[model samples]
Target: MIAHSVEDPLYYLHNFRQVLQWVEQRYADLLDDQELAFLQAFVALEQSAQALMVRMVMRKGELFRSDRLDYAEIGDTVRALQPLQALGWVREPEQLSLDQLFALLRKDELAHGFAGQLSRPRAAKSDLFAQLQGLALAPRPLAQWFEQAPVGILQWCLQPLCDRMRLLFFGNLYQDWSDFVLADLGVLRFEQVPFSPGSRALQQRSEVDLAMALHHCTERLEQGEAPAAILDALAQWRSDNPWLARRHGRLLFALGRHCERLGDWDLALTVYGRSNHAQARIRQVRVLERCERWAQAHELAVQLAAAPANALEVQALQRMLPRLARKLGGPAQPRRRTTAPQLIELELPRELAELGVEEAVRQHLAQAGAEVHYVENTLLNSLFGLLCWDAIFAPVPGAFFHPFQAAPQDLHDADFQLRRAALFDACLGRLDDGTHRQAILDCFATKHGLQSPFVFWSMLDQALLEQALACLPPAHLKQCFLRLLQDIRNNRAGMPDLIQFWPEQGSYRMIEVKGPGDRLQDNQLRWLEFCAEHHLPVAVCHVRWGGPA
Candidate 1:
């Protein structure tokens, strides 16, 4: 490991030299001694040029207000070395050592020719450096002395040539260069050519070469390539190749989404549902919701909601719930959050020292002089807040407050728990602000005293629990519920669920419950809209003594 304290460039240079020397000399005789010596000289010349360039960049940065020039110079200089191509040089396909290959390439580049080029006065010569600087950079070699160039460079060159051919033959290219490039790179078998540079000669490519091509396809997809094209390529790959079923399933999910956009709803549903995994099930639910298939979406949502209050799974279900609600035509409601309720208030926590609500709550509770105290858990507080809003804001308001609302007598604590749970039940499908959603999340974040029957029930209000039970398949729900209970039981004290609710399930409905003085945030409202679109149920219950808004 590099020393944490060392900040000098020479340290990095020393390490780089050591690595090259060890890989070239001690590890193998991949490069001939003369070629290795030359490579070192080339590397030294480049390093020196880099040092000058960095200083130039720094000087430019000092003079100008912009950093772009500095960045461009550094980036261009580094990329000019063609690191990947260098590795290809000394690399022996049968016994390829990437380190050894790089070392050998470095040795060659550092030789007399490269050094002579640098030391000699700049002149108008049509040499490699001049050619490189004109319109492009150095052509990265495949191996130090290998005849074939790196697969990447070949693919790069092949793409435009293939496009030219397509434009010449077809009206327009049917697909992006990605699919073709990926195919070319992933070529499993190819007929060897004797120093040919024609496009036709390059048609037959090997599979190892195709690795980079497949990666290109993946990148194109990520870069928002037309969904149809991506799906078609993926489907063709699965059809023609021998991939593991699990791998195929993943790819199918990816392709299915494109199908969804292509108005092939049935195909999307089919692909999403075919996978037996829980993730697949959730995805299947999402596709169904997108199609406005509420009944199916509701069923899945309920199943997930009831399964268990695992921080992860519960989080997923929570995300799905609002969409399910919106699909069911739950009324449009204002978004609310107990914390950071407004744009002005959002800045309060950092700028206005006195406006810290949690601290205020802590102080209030501390001064109450009561022996018994509620857990200072935000979720628990939010749950009570939700219950409070429901009662005070219901069309016909009720008078009872949850036990956790204030200090309760010892004897009433048990009764308070029951009443509080019932209150949660009453607003079962209701949506609130961030405060209430946070409560549900927190409940799942911590362990319930028991595991099995009470697991989901303890974490959520009764109605949601019932809805979840009603909707989800029994087995899947059981798995999610169990997982929830396990996570809470395992990591008792950890970073409370913050920006990231859970992995893979980050895309879900997030609700916040607030009080009378509280109002919903724009982000919270946007989230509500998102939930509604996903057909998740959202009920914002404002528990004011007055009638519902």
Candidate 2:
């Protein structure tokens, strides 16, 4: 059953209440006094008052003009807001800056209110604001700014508190109240995994605060804050929580990139050195090379090459080591190269170009005895998702914290596979006993349409599933799945665009299509190399627009 329907006028209120109740029940100990009081006072509010507060919380920005808010379900907006205002949850803004005032006022209102200041009354709002910049207006209340203001601005003061509750419930700030509405409306769906009592995302109050701090730091970085300042702020934080630590690492990595763009090599080196992100070390090497520190670059590149983190790192080192060696006046290192995949050259009618290269290729390949489909990254990932549904959705502590998650929280963590090694082994064991086909089919039938981290329900139907099972060898599937588990964050993508099955012969070939002038991406190259090493039937299909010569 759905959580809440949009047909209900109080759907948003219901969703908000659900979050509050969830947080209150699961994270009571972690809640501050203010948060606990909010829960208590919110329940005591009248239905309209609660609804009004939720409407404001869901909307963008803190300030809302009273006249702009009109809800039919809540009889009077002002009346509904009174209880909230009395509780200090909503208040008239004590002051607003000129920019804030400009944001709140309409162009007509600005023109009408400051007639003498605006030399060109018909000028754009931005130009009007620019002309008034010389006045050097100080921030003041709406009343003090204008003699007769059309509407009073009300600010939602408790947004941060509400946001804390949301963070606790959703595990991240990216997914907001709209997620609940989307789930309710059936626009999005998630698997309902049972949660243990200790399955919450942030276990301690400190962790919650740290997550919020990292979020704010990210915002400041995006707003063009100096990298040095953000780095200083980050250096003060330390977290044992791996999830939060990963977030911290990502922020550092982003700051490092920003520094690189600004040509701040020293800062970028420091930032990259501090990050544990997968690509950070490679970036550090590149930065060293760029700054002409060939010895240091070569030393680090050699260390990384000795124990590369993943395929991407290996791919990068192949290019870096040779260049670094040349710069350091050392012997030229023999670069490792993979044999290119078998090639198919096509020249199709220009009229067929509109169908897209992959589609055109699929059409050309499809025949009386062959079946072709544009599967891309979906088919293999979906197969793996279906075959290992239990392992992926296991009820491990801190994994399935909420019912709305499509996959476990640590699906991309370094230890994701290790934590569920036994479970995955059991799941993959079906291959040996010749039960994997049935297991995959059963999952496809039973768990169809449920959200998953890997499965693409919209793409994988019964026909494709059967054909893949019939043609692709279990050994081949196992190899690909193992590679996926090696580094899911990077390896989940870059699969061939199309696959053709000769069901009669129990054989299939994966095809990576390249239109004229389009070349293989790095990830695609990695996948092609992997397939070649495994002796998997794969090819690169190159296409030109004109008719065959």
Candidate 3:
């Protein structure tokens, strides 16, 4: 009986042969030629692990085939000094025979001891592959090897052993092959499994497996697993794991995709916020926009724009804002301007004079370098200064485009004058009668362009346009409007070709061909407001050039 843990029967038999040879060599000088011959004869019992009493007597001659050939019984036969068993080798009398001994001893010693001797200097060199190969080729069943060790211990011994062989011999060619088997067998203790270095290391040179993981995740998501759970798992795993930046970015985006599919906008927002890339941020903003969370979307867009102009983000924000505005009842109305005590020249305090307004504006801009400008004043060039000085400031959440909120405030004397100038410019050719005459209005209108405030007067005289502007504040616009209308009707202003006096309303107004998609710039808006306020029935005709009106 050979005392050993027999994982592979053929390999065990070969190991026995090598041990038998060593025994023979050690006792060569001590024992007579006859004794040496006896040892050799006993070695023959090894018999190529196929031809022996253990094979012939046991129906199939399989070792450890039954519990009957117990260890104690087998050991008794070997120590009984039977010719087939000697020295440290154990033998069994019931299955041993002279012919089997001779056949086993005749085989070469090197085949059996290859793993032992080759790996003597380093235990890690143990040829697990060689043993596996030997077992695979064996004719007899060796079920005892699988049963002897506890399942956990067996896995401990086999997992890394198999992993090493799979990595060393197969490399990338058979990458998925091993992993599939492991996963199928339910042997992968997912949480405990050390991040398998094989695929991970290979992922550096090739992203084959990583890409496959992504595809698998997507498939799983499509199949309807909660995307949030998958993302949480990935997040926990990705948090401390040092991964390739690009690959990491891809995984984060994939996670965002799942959240987006689920319509979990808030979760998607969180996912994007954690990632560093601008592209990922853009993707996140898109999800918010899709959810119709314009304020948040616009906020992110402005934030990204303020720091660095990502063209992608800028374009996305531009496209998203108009849709959002329509959904949110259009852009916010400009707040009424506030007033301060009159000033002819700067009675500058020492501190104020030392720190110029220009410098103050620059400093303020620099210190508050938010990516998006929340204040409407920041959006327009000319109104910036007036707005800064006159608007009452309050900050509101979800106020993306305008950071500072302006509540309605009474206009300052200067603000009143500036607004009057805008109303005059806008009413120039459009108004029939007004003070300062046609020349004065023309100078303001020509210099200011359509969006200018100076255009307010003429627009108010036309139909319902004035109602819209009058709906906004400062009270004085209404006062200025009525005064301008009075002047226009009283032969105080010039009438243009487009201008016509409404006899019933006693006001001059212009006929504007306007419709949806036609926006009045600031200057144009004043005149439209004036028309609407005075009850002028201005017709809005939308005609396509190539089509019949």
Q: After superposition, how far is residue 406 of candidate 2 from its true place, in Å?
A: 2.3
lDDT (10s digit) by residue, model 2, range 460-514: 9898899999999999999999899988999999999999999899999999999
Per-residue alpha-carbon lDDT of model 3 for 101-129, expressed as tens digits? 22232122222323343333222323433
Off by over 4 Å in 2: 111-124, 183-188, 331-334, 349-351, 545-549
**CA lDDT scores, all candidates in order:** 0.37, 0.89, 0.36
| lDDT against true structure, model 1 | 0.37
RMSD of each: 21.8, 2.4, 33.2
Residue 255, candidate 1: Cα error in Å is 5.8
Better of 1 and 3 by TM-score: 1
lDDT of 1 by residue, 1-549 (tens): 121112444333343343344333322233345445544654655664433322432231112111222343245633533442264321113332333233333333423324433433243333433433444333333444244432211111113322333222111234331222222222222212122112111122232123234445556766777755655565544322211233345455665666667777777777676543335566667777878899888887787667643334544566677767776888743433322221111212232234344333323333544211222223222333332333222211111111111111111111222334455444433332324344444444442322221222333554443332233233332232222223322222221111112223222112233334766554444334433444443334232222232
Off by over 4 Å in 1: 3-6, 10-215, 235-264, 274-278, 294-353, 368-549
Model 1: ten consecutive residues of lowest lDDT: 396-405
399 Cα displacement, candidate 1 (Å): 54
Clash counts for the predictions, in order? 69, 0, 59
Better of 2 and 3 by lDDT: 2
**TM-score preference between candidates 2 and 3, better one:** 2
